[model samples]
Target: MEALLLRVVPGLSEEWQGATPDEIERIEQLAGRPLPPFYRWFLSRMGKSMGKLTYPGLDFSASRVLTCYAEKRITPEPRFLFIAYNSDETMPLHVFYDLEAPARADALVTWGDTWGNVLHEGFETLREMLAWGAVLSFRVGKMPQQCEGIITGEPVGFLSRFDSVMSRLGFTQPVPTGPYCRLYERPDAAMVCSSPSAATFKGGQAFTLGGVDEGALRRILGEIATEPSLEVEVDEWMPELG
Candidate 1:
């Protein structure tokens, strides 16, 4: 995917729509880490989610972590990741809630508006930090009061590095916040999922949180599924992708 993203140029011709060997190497240099397995597989199925979900306009699954509207190519905004904490589960935390997970008492250190996670709070506190931390700090908005993140990848050692941080904050099992995003200046939210994850979008597209109108949502999703394909440029940026 990084390789594919490298060849992408703003408003370039269609010839630059595919990834080249040189472009891939450049992206690897930029990302530092090689793309993940899922992303690798996702690259094979490029443009699958083309026109599916346009809110975050997520190019691939990983793109939903930030707050940027999706277009035909990567949004100009640099990527950012904010892991939210959930405190209503068992075992190592998995999900990333989009709300503010740290509080006044839970702050590790502050330089004014900088509220850091209390990973130094200790294991139990870490559990609490991930739990009561309002996990939605990753994305700000009025989302479901009780949305849970799906935690896959059994034996998720990815969270081990922060174990000490978790312990310092007095946390146990916490609720998991799944991948989500929000609009620029609204309380609306949009979720990312392979199987038709739908919700009200920034541009007036709306759907119930859950258990409200699945049939209606399904119909809306079906219509959305049929929308025009979202065109993507391999190593180019298009100011007028629309």
Candidate 2:
């Protein structure tokens, strides 16, 4: 995990200041449960770093961790510990610690803040979780390089994998209702087309062009891609595709 953090966010190790053993003990006392071994090791290594990675809104400091746990200490079911949160503090990410496991190091299950539904599970250790996050971070452009070519250079397959990783990491956008033409306005002045059938919205770069026929959709997309002054009304009902 530390190695991955260094690779993804360079100079993270130097910036990190781990918590003292006494601080860790105090945190445990407050939480009324022993910290997982992998998590404790993580805290002992880099718990004080203010660096933000993966989730842009979160810091991995011990204080932040303790605060999140305290905030959710009253919630019931699927007992877990909060690890990180989104920018608005609406979503919290957590890890389920198995009390019965040997040293509580058997496996780690992660989840988002959607009523305790599991986001990911069966990670052998916290290191595995970090490793997965590293790959996912790369996919989402949070990390340095483009992960598209790392695995397979094919755009379609790479995009599929990218969406899969985002889903696993609980990065999802609200699906527009009825019919919509989703557009991806690219940096190179190219427009990408996406719809319910296409499902090509990548990394949240899409806007709803609600209820348009194929021709109108193409015209509006082209106008938006090139000229900023053009405006068009979208129909509420989607035309049937032959």
- Best model per lDDT: 2
C-alpha TM-score for every candidate: 0.21, 0.44
Cα lDDT tens digits for candidate 1, 1-242: 22322222222233223333443334333334453333233323332232211113113223321212223122221121122222233322222211122322221211110132222212111222222222223222133221222212212332332222223333322223221211111123322211111131112211122112334323323333342331111221112122
lDDT at residue 60 of model 2 (Cα atoms): 57
In the range 1-242, model 2's lDDT, one tens digit per residue, is 45545755666666767877876876666546766777778778767763444346655567765665667642434355555444445555554543333223523444555345556543434554454444343323331212111112233343444344334433332221111121121221112112222233222222233212355445434443342222223332223344
Q: Which candidate number has the best TM-score?
A: 2
> What lDDT does candidate 2 reach at residue 119?
62
Off by over 4 Å in 1: 1-25, 47-49, 56-208, 212-242
Please list the residue runs of candidate 2 whose C-alpha ends up more than 4 Å from where it truly belongs after superposition.
1-9, 30-33, 50-54, 71-78, 89-106, 114-124, 135-242
